[model samples]
Target chain A: MVASSTARTGAGGQTLVVDLAYPPDPGRAPFTRADLVVTGVDHSGTSYEVRLYLDNPGADIDTPRDPEAGYAGRYTVFGHGGCYGDEGHCEVPEAAGDPTDVRPVHQLTPLDTFVTVTDALRRVLDRDGRLSTVTMVPVSLTPRRSDRSPAPELLEFADLSLHTYLAATDLDVPTPG
Target chain B: MGVRRSAASLSVAELTDLRDAFTALYGISDDRGYAFLAGVHGLPLPQYCKHGSILFLPWHRAYLYFMERAMIDALRRSRDDPAAAVSLPWWDWSSAAAHADGGGLPPGWLAPADGGANALASGPMTLGDADLEQVRTNLPGAVTDGADPVTVRDPDTPDQLPKATTVNRALSATSFTEFSQIVEGIHNGVHGWVGGAMSAVPIAAYDPIFWSHHAMIDRLWYLWQLSPQGADPSAALLDTALPPWPMTVRQTLSVPNLGYDYAAQVVG
Candidate 1:
């Protein structure tokens, strides 16, 4: 992955880095998928998991316990962070035992995987001749409970990156002049 | 490019009036409420899927597009009705009046009402999770079952709640903070760079109006950025990425990808 710093603060402040990975060329058949990986080092060794989620029909990306089974529809895995006790379904079983799961941590997903999913979605949309936009969000993980209040400190490591792409067929149509 | 139109020319009272009038004309209730909404917006009938979910941002933009169209249509009908006194109004929640007390809840939008804790109830009243469930269980046919489809239930009457009451109650009470809070709360209240993966499903399954809510939230951020106490104006709160993801400020501002444009005045 190619990385560049876009936003920087003082020495003590955190810096926002932009990673530009190779795009999937429609001319080519399928290509190797790339993952957007963020690694965070705390007292413990680096710990992370790669996650991908569907952006449509917004719902919880992680499956819930029996009590929350009713709300399974609203799931999306856009960013990575510390593992929670109930995040059992989304958790990499080996990493769940770590107490640091509650602390700041990074979640990684190969970039190519995301593109592939998005590309498939685009093809479906293309077949239907529909114009739509999908937002691909990238977030960094830190050791923190998903339920805790949002703080600048916690936000220090998290960033929201958005990507916009058009299907090859979508490009051929004329946009309003 | 032509000069952008200003949303400032619109007023919240007018929007509320238009919404109410439309509700009255179409008979806003659970069974036909969504259809009325679709009709007013001039949308083709929705082709829904049992397992597919509404895509975020785009879906909402479509909703808002129809809403705007509905408002315009309402305005034209009112011109002929003469009896109708409604007009479109924009809710500028960012105004000082909205945040006078510092809490996020805007005044006058909803009033607290008492009901059994476990039942799903609806109307211009506040009900706990129980009432919410009741409303959910009885949603009209147009409403689809999804991962987090909003629900309502009333424990007291259990069987007697009107569909309209439940839907209106849900629409009025649901907000962005509530959705975000639920997600965070479910995850044990931790905050950090958990990434967009977590938000995807909720956002997708989220009502099409979710985009308008986010647009409103984005508008708040814009307004907050202008405040003296706001975070650094130069700070980039949104991550930048290349297509099929956009990375630059200019790219981020494009409406085609976002699905809708803020009334220029709202941005100001």
Candidate 2:
């Protein structure tokens, strides 16, 4: 990972903002590509969509999904609905359940989602040279119960990071060989 | 042994046999019934599934195997000889043809069956009072008052379906974990694109197309497993148990060992 940043959910779980910077040197950049890696994504609730915008501070659900608007890309989480099993069945054990237990981890365990935003990141970098904050707009598709005491949150993730990678160096060749 | 083919390539006879199997299974009305198998995915009691975990792919593979085997049993009960020949066909939603016509739903799944309801398009969502509450618990206002609440779909435009490039990139993944997440994201997008009951996980499996959709995902994993860049899952993951089904991750890795293999597309 070359250039990276991390962030949690924003106020009211409406949006998330994370700081992302461009590589220092473009001529001989260390990284060949970039990606937006979302880690520890909780899929135990209703499904929803998260639209990522590069640097548009005012980006919202109404924002146009295009490069001009800093709309990088979007991804959806197919939620597991909710736990209907017996008590503790859906709980992610802090440690292994039992020493001899062979059962897999809870189905609702947090997972990771990765999106290769190379083109989007490059477009922003080329224009501004150095890119900053990424704004995410979350929209829940599942209908919630109006009478429920507390509304269930649609967006839950541990961290949103920008990761860059290095490709194999180009082969050296003699001039006019 | 069974050979699963792309849903688009199934012959008229093959489609008929598959539909017949569904009808036969639907009629059983017992634990072996279609509804019972479908409910096992989500809703009612025992929502045996593994999503958002490393076991996501392998668990669903075992689930599909269980359902396919039950379909064979249903065909056998109806005295349909060579029942084993009929394996579940996958809806290739990420193919060139799928995205060509604005990304329409699979015609075989949507088309009406001979002289009546198409079991492929939709099937009876037999939910009891408790089960109905379970649906509303997650989905809120789904399954309103109705005598026959058959599964319904409100699919998005074909353009909304995942592009072939999206899936091709997932297939190119070097690690099983990376491959699963990419493919799973695509899977989630397709589920939401299908909307209606299909969009919600609790009642998703009740829709007949869910089986084929998962079959498509399972097929992708099978292809990835055989690819040069593909590597076997970690040792711990391979040995983990997918409950409600007796199989482990290792057992589900080999499609042929589970008695089925996806057929190579028959190009003209």
Candidate 3:
């Protein structure tokens, strides 16, 4: 409902460059705030990407153009998960050498799906940590593959749940005071 | 060597053999190809999943069995030993071995020499469009071109992986949904723990350890089936057919009937 109308890039609204490789290889851990994370709170506080999970197949995710570019969808409670935080900031790097890379516009559905998944996510700090994640992706004007490339339907999404799981940090997600 | 053992009990040599076999499959780009093998996952055709549904345990059980058979065949052909019985090992991240060293990634997957080629991180891969589009155009039996990849950034941090007790707790759920979801929670944790190519749902199978990770998941389900609370699904769920997959929920319930089993009792 209440969200900023601008997609959060980096410190001063700059899109951060990230290297993505599949058949996953070892890389940096979620050691700092700069590392991309997934959560219920959006880092930008605005320009929210409304993502939908696999359970919902008939959800609307079309984003209005012009001044309402990224804010067409509902508040993306299931926060950012990939590198560069929000979907708006991530792009497939220019030089995709041997293993190729491409920036597929990640898509998300409008909010309203309730009781998503309420399961236990064990935490080293807490014994009974339950992970009740809210899912979201960018408001896609069209459908495509997980790579963010243009596809037919806008209903699909990459199962980036773990990215959200590993990247959850207190920095991005503020505690209600 | 025939059964799927825990990553902790495995020797570096044994892990190396599995690693090499996995890589060998990756090299095949045709039917029953490496990419095809990996494509049978969640990306393009996210259908017929044995998760959030009745087939969650059985479907994966069948998938793992098929994979083991493929590995056995590969080993026989490549090594020219008809008796090269090498079943993929399982990595119970919640176990002690996960906390041993470089996260849950065994030395074979991390070591530059042994599993270096098959090491998901050791190789160079450009992450982008080509991969997402692979299943739709290249691979077979995908959904209506609607799928997503799994997300993982760092795959070798030990602390990042789940503990054995964490998984044991998942087995305590009373209902099928509770048990499956908790099990999946652990499954998702490992994928994220071994982030990188293994993070995405579709491309996870490409990683050598993905099968092992899923094996652990499947094994947990097996353990549940043997428990007191575990029972057959209700009629509606049992009859529900997983699309693009010929088998129904009832068809995938048994591991013994599917042939092969996991090694040792993965005590909760």
**What is the C-alpha lDDT profile of model 1 across A1-177, one tens digit per residue?**
223234322112321223322232333233222213222311111112222222221212232211112110111122322221133423323345776555212122211111123343334334433312222222223222232221223222333232343333211211100
Which one wins on DockQ?
A: 2
Candidate 2: stretches off by over 4 Å: A2-13, A23-29, A83-93, A96-103, A143-152, A168-177, B80-84, B111-115, B140-144
Fnat of every candidate, listed in order? 0.07, 0.45, 0.00
Instruction: Tell me the tens digit of each residue's lDDT in model 2 across A1-177.
Output: 433446545535467766665554443264655677888888887777788888776677667788788887777888767777778878888765478975556567788887777677777777987677788787765533232121226767877777766753111111000
The C-alpha RMSD in Å for every predicted model, in order, reads 20.7, 5.7, 15.7
Better of 1 and 3 by lDDT: 3
Ranking by TM-score: 2, 3, 1
Cα lDDT, model 1, residue A61: 23
Superposition TM-score, candidate 3 onto the true structure = 0.54
Please state the error at residue B115 of candidate 2 in Å. 9.7
Q: What part of the reference interface contacts, as a 0 to 1 fraction, does candidate 3 reproduce?
A: 0.00
| CA shift of A144, model 1, Å | 21
For candidate 3, the docking band is incorrect
Chain A TM-scores of all predicted models: 0.24, 0.76, 0.21
Which DockQ-derived CAPRI band holds candidate 1? incorrect
Higher DockQ: candidate 2 or 3? 2
lDDT (Cα) of model 1? 0.27
Candidate No. with top TM-score: 2
